[model samples]
Target: MSHDILRRHLRDLIDAYNFAQWLKTLKGLIPNEFICKRWTSEPNGFIITPIDQIPGLNT
Candidate 1:
């Protein structure tokens, strides 16, 4: 892809990643019951809960 196109795609990816991180943070601020079930979904660079799990947190 051309540099301009690559840069635009990267910018969009970054925006999406940033939005996901913001959503995660927003979820943390809200009550568990009120939060969306999808809050646990992974962001590009954000790790909410690990695959191996953190014992009580993931359980």
Candidate 2:
């Protein structure tokens, strides 16, 4: 595979694993949820909102 294709596959695998972990261990809250909650409490710590880190609207 080309570099871009390989990178995409790797990212997909990571996302799938993360989703499973959230379902199995994290109680349906994503790893990003921690960041998002912190972002809510402390906006100065982040340059961008972690809401974008969430999986929604396919973005």
Pairs with backbone N, CA or C atoms under 3 Å apart (clashes), candidate 1: none
lDDT of each model, Cα atoms only? 0.59, 0.80
Q: Mind giving the per-residue lDDT tens digits that candidate 2 earns over 1-59?
A: 79999999999999999789777775666568766776888999998777875777954
Q: What clash count does candidate 1 reach?
A: 0
On the 0 to 100 scale, the lDDT of residue 56 in model 2 is: 73
| Backbone Cα, N, C clashes tallied per candidate | 0, 0
Task: Please write out the lDDT profile of model 1 over residues 4-58, one tens digit for every residue.
Answer: 9999999999999988887687774533423333445533443553334334664
Give stretches of model 2 more than 4 Å off. 26-59
Best by TM-score: 1
lDDT of predicted model 2: 0.80
Cα lDDT for residue 21, candidate 2: 78
